[model samples]
Target: MAAPSSQIDQLADRIERLLVRYEELQRTNALLQQQVDSLTQERESLKSRLSAARARVDALLERLPTLKNAA
Candidate 1:
């Protein structure tokens, strides 16, 4: 009977510990998710800027053809 009681108490303690660890993991996961969202937004902003720059470069290249004809 004593052995059984001890085993039950140990199991209870393990369950409590596992619950606490799970909570900690949940908080960490939430933080990581927020960071990923922020990074994705930043990536999109950079992509937009890059696209604008490429367009400007293409416009400049197109002008070069006209300039060459005038020369």
Candidate 2:
């Protein structure tokens, strides 16, 4: 025996809702992955900048003795 038309319609609606929720979850996962990638790149860039700044400071410190002798 076949299911009543009303029951089949209800099942179809439930399936459609589940599909929509699945799609939403997929989109959320993709966005989170992008955020992680962006944060990783930013961290690397900050580390590079910090290293360059430290090198500049070290060079200036090395010149201090010569400047003191010349004064």
Candidate 3:
């Protein structure tokens, strides 16, 4: 009876430790997810700016021929 009771206590202690670890891991995962979302938004903004810049460059290039002809 004593041996079984000791084993049960040890198992309970282990379970408590595991629960604490699980909670810590959950918080870390949530923080990582937020970082990923922030990076994704920043990447999208940079892509939009790049696209706008490219369009401006293309428009300027299109006008070069007309400018040259007028000269």
Candidate 4:
């Protein structure tokens, strides 16, 4: 039979380990969430710039026909 004191100590150690793991996971989750938010903002900014660039390209394309007719 196992000693009662050793059994209690083992249980306590397991609980402590679980708590530590939980805290580590919590921290990792928070860091990942922050990174995700930052990436989302960057993606939105890039999309906006892309849209503006496309508009400029379209305007230039529209003028090409007029330029060719005059040549």
Clashing residue pairs, candidate 1? none
Pairs in steric clash, model 2: none
lDDT of 3 by residue, 1-71 (tens): 56998999999999999999999999999999999999999999999999999999999988777865888
lDDT for residue 7 in candidate 1, whole number 0-100: 95
Arrange candidates, best TM-score first. 4, 1, 3, 2
Clashing pairs in 4: none
Candidate 1: tens digits of C-alpha lDDT, residues 1-71: 56998999999999999999999999999999999999999999999999999999999988776765888
Off by over 4 Å in 3: 66-71
Determine which window of 10 residues in candidate 2 has minimal summed lDDT: 61-70
Highest-lDDT candidate: 4
Residue 36, candidate 1: alpha-carbon lDDT: 100
Instruction: Write one digit per residue (lDDT tens) for candidate 4, span 26-51.
Output: 99999999999999999999999999
Please, what is the whole-model Cα lDDT of each candidate in the order they appear?
Answer: 0.96, 0.95, 0.96, 0.97
Candidate 4 least-lDDT 10 residues: 61-70
Q: Which residue runs does candidate 2 get wrong by more than 4 Å? A: 1-11, 66-71
What would you estimate as the lDDT of candidate 2?
Answer: 0.95
Error of 3 at 48 (Å): 0.5
lDDT assessment of candidate 3: 0.96
Quote model 4's TM-score: 0.88
